[model samples]
Target: MKQKWRNFMTVLVLKINKNRLHDEEFVRPVTDLLEDFKVVDYREVKNLDFDKVIICGTALKDNEYLDNLDKFSWLKNCKKPVLGICAGMHIIGKILGYDLIENKKIGVEDNKYYLHSFKIEGLDESLEVENFKGMLFHPEVLNKELIKDFVNLT
Candidate 1:
């Protein structure tokens, strides 16, 4: 008998929500768009083997991940490229010494308005700190092609 190997790229998706309901709104879309992905809570991400990391966003009111910033300290020393989405952007911003501006928004409509709604203290349209990069907007919703291209490029 011979052992065979399958060539599939795996991308790690760090879930930022405390409530599972938000998965359909945030996590599931990214996982569905990718050919291969693994969704795990942010706290359990250390020592995992992944080609890249995508920090998934959460509901507008879900700030549970913010309470546990220590779990994300590993990101500072991580060599692999990391892409942070909405809520994930705040995590990256907080880890990078940026101030988090929390706002109270009711109801879910089109999120495109969020792009211009609030600003992270010192972040910009594109983030390139050391090896990590982040975008304030949701690429999966705004530009699905970029996500697909990223998978192919990486």
Candidate 2:
């Protein structure tokens, strides 16, 4: 018999929660998007050996996760492609030296909204997936300058 795929894909989910209180905020879409991928917690983050990594979204925006931020220093030097959603984006912003601001004044409403349209700047059209219009949760806000470190990709 011939083998088609020889490797397993594992994603190390860098959870920012201090306890299990915010398990729901962790990335679940990762499993839904890839059938052959494994998502693990941050138990061995410093000694990790994963192909892809996901910095999970959080429920708090007061920078509470900062208590555990030191563990994620690896992110600054990580070479793999990263996708930060909501608070995850905030973490990435924090890593990129963006000051955390109070987005709480924006109010709380995480309901999904239709994304009228999006324009991804650099990705090839052939690599495009169906663009999602509506966001399912209230996204955490970061400074406008956070885009500087990113390519046409963020």
Top-TM-score structure, candidate number: 1
- lDDT for 72 in candidate 1 is 94
- Sequence-dependent TM-score of model 1: 0.81
Q: Model 2: how far is 87 from its true place, Å?
A: 1.9
lDDT of 1 by residue, 2-38 (tens): 2222326788889988888888878987787876788
Question: Where does candidate 2 stray beyond 4 Å?
Answer: 1-8, 61-63, 105-154
Candidate 2 local lDDT, 1-154, one digit each (tens): 3212222555555565455655553445333333344454544465557655555555543346666666567777876656554555555655666544443322333332111112122321112122211122322222212212221232
Look at candidate 1 and tell me the lDDT of residue 144.
64
The best candidate in terms of lDDT: 1
Give me the overall lDDT of model 2. 0.43
Residue 41's lDDT in candidate 1 = 90
